[model samples]
Target: MKPKVIGKCIIEKEEFPDGRIRIKRTTEGITAFELYWHLEQAQEEISKQLMGLLKPDIIKRR
Candidate 1:
């Protein structure tokens, strides 16, 4: 664990073979923050694409 996030960490997953992500709630477990970040980024991109029909804000923001 990084020194900065030693106490604040979690175990999360994304893009499973079953087409689902899973988050673990075990104690003293490893955390996949990288996966979480990518998943969130993907969701945002997808939302922007889906909302593009109603919103043109992303074009300017991006």
Candidate 2:
């Protein structure tokens, strides 16, 4: 089963356009990092990171 999303942390680069990293937290206490370079990238990365939080092994690999 997939975990529920609980929170997020986003970091934006002041000097670079579309440069950002986002970290999402799940109800299961898992977190995943995302790298973004554009609007699509930001959306895609958040989705990818949230999916990563669903796997039990993802935390161990960090």
Best by lDDT: 1
Compared with the true structure, all predictions reach lDDT values of: 0.66, 0.56
Give the winner by TM-score.
1
Minimal lDDT window, size 10, model 2: 28-37
Q: With candidate 1 superimposed using the best TM-score fit, by how many Å does residue 43's alpha carbon deviate from the native?
A: 0.3
lDDT of 2 by residue, 1-62 (tens): 55443356454434445676555533332323212235568789899998987787777789
Look at candidate 2 and tell me the lDDT of residue 11: 47
Off by over 4 Å in 1: 1-31, 54-62
lDDT of 2 at 27: 39
| Model 1 lDDT tens row, 1-62 | 45222234556665688788777753443346755777899999999978876567757677
Q: How many residue pairs of model 1 clash at the backbone?
A: 0
What lDDT score is found at residue 36 in candidate 2? 23
